[model samples]
Target: MAKKKAVGQRGSWFATVDGIELPCAHRRWAKKNWPHYHDPFKPTENGPSASKILKYVQAIKDEKQVILTNDDEHLDDEGELTGFTRLNYIAIYGVENVSFDPDAGLKFTITKRLVELR
Candidate 1:
């Protein structure tokens, strides 16, 4: 029998937009909750495409700033980080590039420009 593939064995993809290391999995919650902003990727299915993600990044970058926070902060009354809630606002920067690794998944790099921490 063929050896079974491990979970996330194929790894993931990451994109660095406006100096933020945005992992492909980072916006999972947004993908499900806010389809307008987040578009999930599933290489195995007809899911998000690279250009689509790039567009999203560009849109966010155009904002010139954004608020970011830990996914845990979106927990529901049941103490589960499921559903939508106010996202912690974090400073924004510039994009560098997006990378992929078969073992490590996706990796992103941010711009070298300095961004004030709020």
Candidate 2:
């Protein structure tokens, strides 16, 4: 796709996939809405969610299959398996009252969806 860039030595930006991961479209974000596209939400509970869209930018990539996992099993600080599942990341997009959408034609619903640049 976008030349795959130099595969970062690290896969998970947070070092580990223990929580809901919000990637910055890797650095390609600079060309898009940048913070607007990558930072739709501010993380309130942990941070604060975005209130309104300053600007809306169209998507660039074609592949819609997100890096999702049904097994949303997370690990606590002590490395113990937590029962809570962070599979639903729609909140990151400032979406409320959401429900899972498997159809690849819609926006980030309530299910686990990810994107992988090939």
Candidate 3:
């Protein structure tokens, strides 16, 4: 089990959980395949879907049983969320579907799934 980093260190670099480490490879993948606008934190309809996000959330629950709730309800002037992507990076994979294994990453699938749901 990979121990959680002490706040804002390398955790910002890769996705780590239960001592398992999934690094920038995942983030880079999400960036390349995901839509140009899809941001995780401030998840907009333009970004990933609640279902896809739900997958990640489920994964986290499976691994550590942690719960992540949306704290912000306001969008930006242009209508963007606080940052992008919830659960942070290192801890993101725990959210589930953060990676797709082959083509496309979690964000892309989530964004697409969100569109389909809509």
Clashes of each: 12, 9, 15
- TM-score list, all predictions: 0.30, 0.19, 0.28
The CA-based lDDT of model 3 is what? 0.34
**Native-to-model Cα distance after best TM-score fit, residue 15 in candidate 3, in Å:** 2.1
Q: Compute the lDDT of residue 10 as modeled in candidate 1.
A: 22
Candidate 1 yields a Cα-based lDDT of: 0.37
Instruction: For candidate 3, write residues 1-118 as lDDT tens digits.
Output: 4435412233133243446533222333244554321233433456556565556544533453222212223457986443433333332322333333223323323222110000
List CA RMSD, all candidates.
16.0, 13.6, 13.2
Per-residue C-alpha lDDT of model 2 across residues 1-118, encoded as one tens digit per residue: 1212112123232111234333222222222542222323322344211221211111212222223222244466987544333332221112222222222212332222232322
Model 2 clash pairs?
42-48, 43-47, 43-48, 44-47, 44-48, 66-114, 66-115, 67-114, 67-115
Q: Can you rank all candidates by lDDT, best first?
A: 1, 3, 2
Q: For candidate 3, what's the RMSD? A: 13.2
Give me the runs in candidate 2 sitting further than 4 Å from their true place: 1-44, 47-62, 74-118
Score each candidate by Cα lDDT.
Answer: 0.37, 0.26, 0.34
